[model samples]
Target: MSADTSSRSSRQDAFDPFLQPELFEGVRSRRIIAFIIDAFVITLLTLGASILVFILGVFTLGLGFLLYAILPVSVALIYAAFTLGGPSASTIGMRAMGLEMRLWYGAKPYPLLAAVHLLLFWFSISLLTPFVLLVSLFSDRKRLLHDLILGTVVINSAYHRAYTREHSAAA
Candidate 1:
């Protein structure tokens, strides 16, 4: 590479999560708590959906009962995707845990990116379970496989909020 290209590459490398541990402080523990909270939220939503489906099914002469096959999963996915992909880039759980997801470069994710991130996370967790959590133990960013694959990071919300305030002040 040319000198300029080499310099830019080196700068990027310096910003790598593996090289900068501060960015990921407390993320591992917070992530676990966030998952628990999110699961509870999804469960509540699914239960509510199930009740609604049952009522509708009864009124519809049992036709609505067919929805039971799909309601829970659909409700969970929709809730997860919408909340995680929203402007806040956090689910209710993550918010409660004071965490948020962002691009590796520290930009807030758009809704689609957020949804895909959650989808990838679920896929990885389903496939690897314990192994996925183990991967975070070795990562400097405390990132699981899906986070690494998607070029994203979960960081302390206080850091993000401070950064936002500083930038807004500068602007």
Candidate 2:
């Protein structure tokens, strides 16, 4: 390969967990914390949505009961779509934990990808909780089953920020 092609390939290889484990340093622990924070935030949002649904049901002669039943799921979907689909590719919890999700190629996922990622995550958790968790333990990237399926990885935002700063300075 030419020198230019070799340089480009090396840059791409830097993101491969097997080639450079540092790219995913501390990701497993941070991901767990981020999950906890996201769950708490989702719960609070669902609760508020449930209350609104209840009030509306009172006015609709109890028809809001159906809405109340799905309020939690709906709230979670909206929150994940809006936050994870943003430029940061992270939810509020992920941001708080200084983590972000990116495609395997290091690109931010679009809104649709984020929503699908969330759906796949919930599905995997519901059907294969133990297996899903175990999958990450065996992977060099520390990626869960859903992440693998979606071709995405969760990375430390702080590390990315530092790398960006250093690279920009060099440039």
Q: How do all models score by TM-score?
A: 0.82, 0.87
Off by over 4 Å in 2: 1-14, 18-20
In the range 21-101, model 1's lDDT, one tens digit per residue, is: 565788899889999998889899989989999999999999999999988768777886688777788899899988888
Alpha-carbon lDDT, every model: 0.81, 0.86
* Error at 48, model 2, angstroms: 0.8
Query: Mind sharing the TM-score for model 1?
Result: 0.82
Worst 10 residues of 2 by lDDT: 13-22
Per-model root-mean-square deviation over C-alphas: 3.3, 2.7
**Among all candidates shown, the one with the greatest TM-score:** 2
Between which residue pairs do clashes occur in model 1?
A: none
Tens digit per residue, CA lDDT, model 2, 38-82 = 999999998888888889999999987889667877888888888
Error of 2 at 109 (Å): 1.6
